[model samples]
Target chain A: MKAKIYITLKAGVLDPQGKAVEHSLHNLGFEGVTGVRQGKYMEIELATEDKTKAEADLDEMCKKLLANIVIENYRIELE
Target chain B: MKAKIYITLKAGVLDPQGKAVEHSLHNLGFEGVTGVRQGKYMEIELATEDKTKAEADLDEMCKKLLANIVIENYRIELE
Candidate 1:
């Protein structure tokens, strides 16, 4: 099985790197771009057939280390 | 309009950061996790109704600065 996780800064959080990229994009003539938010994507390959246990473990991983609960949110897609 | 871009190191590329994270996950007791690939996710909010143009511009951004074409691949989702 494969799982893809997306971790991103929460709303109202200050994303300096995202802002910088947005600014650069605008400067590069990308018109109409109003805002940008940057985040992380992690793809994990597992050999298990138990998706329930896998998801549970992955959720725990996200909360414990993959995502900063205080300022970031995460979503997982399993395949 | 909103566009979400997912960028990642291409297959066969050496991803040191991803390997480190995978090792940490294994240490943290995520069983069955065999490999991990890390990437970037960027969300852009645009004020225009032109999806085609936005996608084109975003593709350019990804190729030029948002992603390293030599080692990375990017996908765009428009909404």
Candidate 2:
């Protein structure tokens, strides 16, 4: 089984890195760009095919370390 | 309009960061996790809704900045 996790900042949180990227894109001649938000994506492979177990484990990982739950949100996809 | 970008290391490329994360996950008790690959995810908002133009611009941005084409591949999604 494989798990894909997306960790992104909460809506109200300030993202300095995203702001910097937006500014760089604009300066790079990407005039149409108005905003940018940056996040982390992880692809994990497990030896087991248990989707239920994988999802639970991934959720735990997210809450424990992958994401700062106080300021970030995480989404998981399984395959 | 919004565009989502996923930048990942190409197959066979060494990812020190991913390895470290994998080790940390194991130490953190994510036992089911066997392998991990990490990447960047970005969301961009544009003033224009023209799909064709947005795709072109994003592709250019990926080539020029968002991704290191020599070692990474990027996928773009627009909405």
Candidate 3:
């Protein structure tokens, strides 16, 4: 099985990288472009016996390291 | 109109950050997790007159700033 983790910064967080990208786009003549937010996507392949264990493991991973609880949140999808 | 940009490292590119996250997940007892790849997603809101120009502008942005042409590729989605 495969799992995908989407990690994103929380609202009101200052994202300098995203702001820079937005500015560059506007400079490239991309008219009316506004509000750029950046996030991370991680795909993990795993072999699991059951969904319950997988969910618990994923939750633990997210809380410990997959995401920064102070500024980011993560979601996991099984495939 | 809105455009989303997804940027990912090309295959064979070594990603230390992704590897670190994977190792940490294993330590957190996420068994059988393997092969992790990390990427970036940027959501951009835009008002565009036509798809042609939007695509051109997006292409330019990707080549110049939105992505690193040497090691990363980018895709755009209009919303």
Task: Please provide the root mean square deviation of candidate 1 (C-alpha atoms, Å).
Answer: 0.9
| TM-score of chain A by itself in each prediction | 0.95, 0.95, 0.92
Clashing pairs in 3: none
Model 2 agreement with the true structure over A1-79: per-residue lDDT tens digits: 8889999999989999999988899889998888899999999998878788878888888998889999999999997
Ranking by TM-score: 2, 1, 3
lDDT of 3 at B2: 70
| Chain A accuracy of model 3 expressed as TM-score | 0.92
Q: Report clash pairs, candidate 2.
A: none
Residue-level lDDT tens digits of model 3 in A1-79:
7777878899999999888877877777765676788888877777785788777777787788778989997888887
The list of candidate 3 runs beyond 4 A from truth reads: none
Best by DockQ: 2
Q: Candidate 1 — which residues are off by over 4 angstroms?
A: none
Q: What lDDT would candidate 1 get against the real structure?
A: 0.91
Per-residue lDDT over B1-79 for candidate 1, one digit per residue giving the tens place of the 0 to 100 score:
9899999999999999999998898888886789999999999998888878887888888988899999999999998
Model 2: which docking level applies?
high
Global lDDT of model 2: 0.91
Q: lDDT by residue for model 1 over A3-68, one digit each (tens)?
A: 999999999999999999989988888767889999999999988879998898889989987999
Q: Is candidate 1 or candidate 3 better by lDDT?
A: 1
Could you tell which candidate, 1 or 3, scores higher by TM-score?
A: 1
